[model samples]
Target: MEDNDQRLQRIKKLETLRQLGVQPYGTRFEVKDRAGDLIRLHGRKSKETLEQERIECTLAGRIVALRRFGKAAFAVLQDGADRLQVYLKKDLLGEQTYRICEELDLGDWIGVTGRLFRTKTNEFTVEVRSLTFLSKALRPLPEKWHGLTDVETRYRQRYVDLIANPSVHEIFITRSRIIAAIRSFLIERGFLEVETPMMHPIPGGATAKPFVTHHNALGMDLYLRIAPELYLKRLIVGGFPRVFEINRNFRNEGISTIHNPEFTMLEFYVAFADYTDLMGLTEELFVRLGREVLGRTVIDYQGRQIDLTPPWRRWSYHQAILEVNKLDESVLRDRSSALAAAKQLGVEVDPNAPLAAVLNEMFEETVEPHLQQPTFITDYPIELSPLARRKDSDPTLTDRFELYIAGREIANAFSELNDPLDQRRRFEAQASQRVAGDEEAHLVDEDFLRALEYGMPPTAGEGIGIDRLVMLFTNQASIRDVVLFPQLKPEK
Candidate 1:
């Protein structure tokens, strides 16, 4: 009811301004300067210096705050980066312009031409010589909704959240810088950035259920890509020595603090390189990002300090599971024994799950939460990494590594499995599981297999979760905080 009253009052003001032939919703005002830049350039200047300089400028921003005192007034104009005090006097703006300014309210967009000056109180400010009413806010901003304390409102109405909180703006600014830094770093290293199709005939890149869409013209279903792996690898077969893509991936998965259904990934493939090579490259990229974005090699995430310094702890996957759970190696030998071990340790697992799946469950339950520092869990089981090359030392384990930090998986890398025959067999195994009620199973993409048959070189590929990486750098606890618009349930 109070909101409706405010709306009505603002509407009346709009009508009155129209009567006066003053354009309340205005056209362009030449904005040659911004509040933040003005402050940055001249905040320290003395009153005498500012008066002597007589710096005149045009500015525009939302009227975040207003204080009217009869014929004189003060307001805070919030531009993109910062806010500045604006003073309006009846004698200066004239009666008609002052009346027009009187109609203005909080959240209205206004433009002004002013000279930089120091207030009697010694604060730097803008003294308005003229005013241009750019826009009028019908409803006033909520007084209580000033920050991210109201989670649902903050996520749902991000515009208001951003307006109310300066810190929110900084996070996204840092996000942009991080992405730019990554792009610049990769380009400097001769990695060619490329684009791949988001829709796939068969989702085979990763073991995850996909969001299916239909092409009415073709009368066929296409899946939103779960990963860009196969398409990027196809570029490898096509002879691109180094390729990278920073793009979106969709997965039909549950949401959590760390998980989002639609997210960004930085996937790259390097020719003539193995998974071991990618480990060093991954560490270098992360450490560089830490220094560039956060200005430090060690960062505090959710109260725990994580070191992004090089030579991060590396442990084989089987070793991590055994050491973390204190379980005998026999439990990982077969499904039956693994299930028995999981039951005894109070770790839940499906009785029919494969041996490697059982081991993964144990690892997630025991090992993951303990990986607070940046660590690489390497040599994953062949069953778990269908697209990775088998280690020469052990046919059972693939040359794969998953980097974990702050108890969350940040990147996945592996040596490319170029043998079409091995890939087909793995796909067939996954297909059987899909038929047997596992929806998150890979489908045999014959086209991808055909591309591999054309001969891909010895290459290593990796995907770093950009959202999670941003979360770490910005110290955001939730993926939703990092994502501009996270997947959310329908608003009631």
Candidate 2:
């Protein structure tokens, strides 16, 4: 039978109750106690003893299960903690209330004022003195044993999903705690939290395409921010020594199990600190949060134990990549030799690609998945880091690192570039890439360049993917699982 047809029949039955001088949809209900409290209070009492005491309490919940046996009826009502059985008998409730019980269906919201007692079957229950309908649910719940299983519908109708599966509610609850912990951790460390513009005339944070929108009145085009990196640096130039922002970042890119179109990102900048300090901070924060949130430093993410203890292993990006490809680190010094090594190791190398770009591609395809534990892969090639400060010992590399856990990049940090001249040169190089048809190349933000001319302090900055971190802490498999409203493909 059609679901709506069934709902219509229930609605008609509910209207009949109103016509018979009973309010089917009540305006207010004063619930004195919860179902769980009632059960706990009466579980130890003897049935005969409780029947003599007749403890009065009022409770309201959604009707989950109902069974009618002529004069007597039992209905399971679910409150927040758990469900409790409510017994209705014609002998006790009289014919008028018994008639109302016959019209009540599963999924309707109801209020029951009753005496706490134990049933003959050793079950704790509420023996009703009065019953009322708080709200009439026209539609029935999905089946008792089976639930809403369609993935698209689950995401679209999230409220129904929350009602069907209690675990989904816990996931989002943990997500909020994860973010709150991050903010608290940072604020406690003397970091000033700030907000930056979401729409920018030039998006220069990271290498990614941006969602473009036009301002009709102003006759100008703006891009949704890919990262808050560049603007946060501008704040540093304006003399905010320690700052961070927990905000939404939109990326016009592909979505996957680990990637979302719009996601939360935590960007922080520390003046005079380096990537090394930031690494220590990241490790300590995760370990502390693990102990605080889940009561353990060891988290099981997708069946792998991720230890967030201090002193996470640090390896240079090139070193890790070479080990994955079974090549010696010495081969990384020469471009031609590196290409030859890649070929010998069966790794694809684009001849025209920059050396760092080829190496990064190889690492992502080969080594990233093997970094299953908390580890920092540091010292990336200069070609891959336009905003990072060049290492003094080796100008060919940048003072940067990325934290990888469970095969995904969780955080990116670097000793930020503060020299205006060097910054301009880097932007010009990226502009050249743009001219060569690289759509993902960074744009030259003139204001950011102008801010750098004011002589910003030496600073270290990091951007952590908040959704991915929550997934790790919550033991969720996909980014969508942690995100309440993940972007999805529109139905045809």
Candidate 3:
């Protein structure tokens, strides 16, 4: 009823405006000043100073607050960045302009010609000489609704949420700065930014189910890329020495505090660099971001002070599992023993599951939660890393490391597996797993394999989850808070 009344009131005013030979919806106005810039530049000027200068300016914004008296009134205008007070008096303006001001609504957009002055209370304000109605808002602002507290409405009606909660603007602005900084950092290091395909003929990058669609003309099924790893690596084979891509990846996955089906990633590859070299680069990148974004190496995330200083703690995959669970080497020596140890540790696993999958699950359950500070768990088992290079001393383990911060995996890096023969074997192994009910297993991309035969350089590649990184920097508790429009189910 309130909304309907607002619409009717606006219509009545539109007729009144037409009768007065006024354009309710106005055209071009030469806006000479912004509220924020004016406040910043001349806010300190005294009442006498403003009166002496007689500074004339034109401004435009939405009417967020208004107050009316017998023949005098005050209205607060909210511009793009800040708010300023505008005093409208009928006696100074005769009666026609004051009537136009009276016709104004809370959410209406207007342009005003005014002079700067200090209010009697010493507040900096714009004394309006004339008002031009620009646009009429049908519905009112979300004044009565608690915009931030209601998650469903907050995400659903983001426009209203933004107006009701002014601080929400900072979150998106900070996210933009983070991405721009990443691009600048990589570009300075001779990394060439490139674009990759979002649709793939076959999903071969990461082990995640894909969202598939069909191309009508081509008459073939295409998968929304779960990751751009494969296409980026193809750039390596094409002789691009250094490349980086920042884009969205889609996956058919369940929603959670840390997981979003569609999210952005920063993936980069460098030739002649191993996983160890990339680790040091990763530390430097975060430390640089820390000083640039927050002006310090320490950040408060979810009530914990996370220090991103260099030389973070490192642990081998097997070592972390053993120390966290206090298990003997013999306990995880073979499939049966590892299965028994898992059951004893209360980590459930399918009895028929491969030992590699069970052992990985054990690490996730027992060790990941304790990695609060910046830590790197390295040298994953061979079966778990199909695209990573094998370690020289222990071929059973691959040269890969996953960086964890605040008990969540923020980045994953590895030495690329450039040998076509070995990569083919690993792809076959994953295909077998897929046949046996593991839908999230990698598939053999013959084109990617053939590209491997063309010989890619020994390179190090890494993917950093941009969403989770933004969450930590912004002090947001959930992934939804960082994402502008996170995936959500329809209203029932």
Candidate 4:
């Protein structure tokens, strides 16, 4: 039914109720107990024997269902956790109060003062003495079979979704628990939680397109941070031994089941640590979180069984590409060899792109989905990881690892680059790449270089995608499902 039509009808009903000396909207009703707690408290007793005790309650909620039988009636009232049946009789409530009960609609919120009892069918119920209208719900809730199913409407009217589908509330509850557990885990390990600026003049943390806005007061263009990597590292430069930030990070990118334009990220840095230490920490934290929050080391997502137990399998980028495509190590030396192999394997390659980028594309297309279990794909190509410290044995590869589960990247960590000269050169190369039309390229932040020159301690930092992690824990398929309000296209 149209909302306006229902509202008008309710207004007319209110006038009728007033004429009968009944208030259609009430102010307050003090409920002595919650539905669930009361049920648990009297669990052992039979409903009939319990109701005979003459228990009293001032319960209030929306009337979910109503059945009328001439002078008597039974209505189901839904409070927060559970629903209870309330019986209203003409003998107990006089004619005027009985009339109020008869005129009450299914969606109306009412407060009932009653003594608990049982019916002939032995269903525990409240024999209401008097009823008061708490609020009038003019619009009818959607039918159970066809509740608010449209994605756009569900996001736009999130309150309706939360009301109609209890599971959505559970998902968000679990999401909050996951974040809380992470904080507790870190704090127990002596890490201080911190916050960094969301707006930046030079977004040098990661290679991603940034959402730009003009700051009128500052009279400069400002960009939302895609990652808090640089600023957190500057903390290390200033001698904060351990710090972490769990906050929103905005990225101007394509929206998909796995990617959201704006989402929560947990990025933390630890001085005197490397990717190896961070990897161990990541494994420990995830396993602990899964067990503590979910009460299991294993969870099923879609059709795959994911085990979040620690000591996740680790593979180097070179080895991953070789194993997935059945190419030997000898064939992966340079651009020419990798390009020839790429063509032979039907994998797309960018001729002008760096060798590492091409290999990454191949791995993403061919190998990522096979990583259904918790796995750390380590030793990424140095070119693709400009800010990461290179491996001592292999200058071409960096000490970086991406944690993957259910074939999606969940966390990324690296031994941070601390050499000022080397960082300057990488930034210059990134600037050149930007000039050559890569909008996602990094910017050369002179301030970050100055911090590096000030001699920041050896540090390792990692970013965990909070939305994706929540999705995994909640068994939600789309990133939008976890996000309360995902961005959508403008309605035309």
Which number leads on TM-score? 1
Write out the backbone clash pairs for model 2. Answer: none
lDDT of 1 by residue, 105-175 (tens): 89999999989999899978899999998888887887764444788878888888888886888889999
Displacement of residue 309 (Cα, Å) in model 2 is: 1.3
User: Over the stretch 56-116, how does candidate 2's per-residue lDDT look in tens digits?
Assistant: 8899998878999989999988886368899988899888878888888888888998888
Off by over 4 Å in 3: 22-25, 92-94, 145-148
| Clashing residue pairs in candidate 1 (N, C-alpha, C atoms within 3 angstroms) | none
In order, what lDDT does every prediction score? 0.90, 0.87, 0.89, 0.86
- Local lDDT at 319 for model 1: 90
Instruction: After the best TM-score superposition of candidate 3, give how far the Cα of residue 135 lies from its true spot, in angstroms.
Output: 1.4
TM-scores for all candidates: the values are 0.97, 0.90, 0.94, 0.91
Weakest 10 consecutive residues of candidate 4 by summed lDDT: 139-148
lDDT of 4 by residue, 151-231 (tens): 777877776777666568778888999999999999999998889999999986888999999999989999998888899
Candidate 2, run of 10 with poorest lDDT: 142-151
What's model 3's TM-score?
0.94
Better of 2 and 4 by TM-score: 4
